[model samples]
Target: MISARERLLNYAILIVFSAAALFPMIGVVAQALQFPDLDAGTFRDAWREGHFGTYLRNSAIVTAVTVACASVLSIMAGYALGVLRLPGSEALFLLFLAGLTVPTEAVVIPLYFDLRTLGLDNTYAGVILPQVAQSVAFGTYWMRAYFRGVPRSLIDAARIDGASSWTTLWRVLVPMGRPAILTMVVLTSMWTWNEFLLPLVILNSDEGLRTAPLGLSFFQGSHQTDYALLTAGALIIAAPVVLLYVFLQRRFIAGMLSGAVKE
Candidate 1:
């Protein structure tokens, strides 16, 4: 048990750090509402002027498809590597890990040219595919750790009950690993949603296909002196991610804690 004084000190420290982190965000909101009456029309004006509807829709499509494809691929690859222990699985797992090491900047230019050659430039597929690959690399590593930590007894029981590998994975392990999977989904969604470089390069020719972050950059360029509109646009671009984390924070924390304990 901790002493009351120590607990109070810890709380004080946390409060200090939390305030430090929150002040800037609060300031941004205040700056965005700089009008005398705190008008809400700034956000509306930013939305219309920025053409954020199209940008947000494009971001949604890319993020959803990337997360969905990456999650499925990660689960399968992780299961094969973590649970099945397939031949040369370590080599294959290491190969996936290599993907995580290679920075996007290193390959993005070539990737753009490749996509162009394939006639996929300025298209949703071009944007979605690279992010899916990136997400799957991390997701595979994440899910593999989760699967590897699952109780061996559970696998034995499933086998004795005549569950095929696919059935066991989907019916037994997947349900049990919901927290871990959800954590991956949230993370991948955030990364894909925030990705600027990939979309900037891949969709360079298509203004209609610009993601929110890219749109915000161009919006910022045009509204260089308008801090109110700028901050409003920034908040609009960030709101979905913030709302997502707010709603899923509990499960995300649980999954993180569970992973740490298991590992």
Candidate 2:
């Protein structure tokens, strides 16, 4: 349907954009490799000096818990709001939408104090809970849209087969919504992993509980002049999310495109 000239032009644009995006990443990797001895063990040195093992473990714990809780809550809430059409559902959906509008900066101070009062400060729960709430806000919105777009006839057929609502959701819809669910998981993981402010504020006095981004900030402060170490540390913090996206790129893209074409 398209002319060869237009297709070539599109390819040219894509290549240019891709190169532009990758250029800085390539530069960082190259700079990280710039060691005096050319084998100075920059990444190893950075890892040991930065104490990234603790930070990364903390981050993994927080991200995994947040994503799991948020995904489950979001799916249930979204299904209720999008499919069940319960009384007052629209109002409740708006409440969830309101959560999305509130910036973390606006409440981080009060939240810290409240968590401190509850003895949750400086703990994994402190970091994980707020992030779960934040992710659920967005996740509910995303999954609601996806569920709303699911064919009504398909749902009706499931119901006719003596499937309970819970069974229908788990067996029929969730499997069919794999791409959408995975897309949500990937996004929530990235956001929780890279979160800096929440962990910084909540775990201020607890070095052992620092997340990757918070740890990287301190690493940068101490190694200000050491570009190679800094770059290596940056890469180390970023690698997990990068690998995750690369692994899920196809599903992620498919989910995004599906949303585009659906309601």
Which residue segments of model 1 deviate by more than 4 Å?
A: 1-24, 33-38, 261-263
TM-score of 2: 0.91
Q: Cα lDDT for residue 135, model 1? A: 93
Candidate 2 — which residues are off by over 4 angstroms? 1-27, 33-40
| lDDT, residue 158, candidate 2 | 92
What value of lDDT does candidate 2 attain over all alpha carbons?
Answer: 0.92
Assess candidate 1 and give its TM-score to the true structure: 0.91
Give the clashing pairs for model 1.
none
The local distance difference test score of each candidate is 0.92, 0.92
Error of 2 at 60 (Å): 0.5
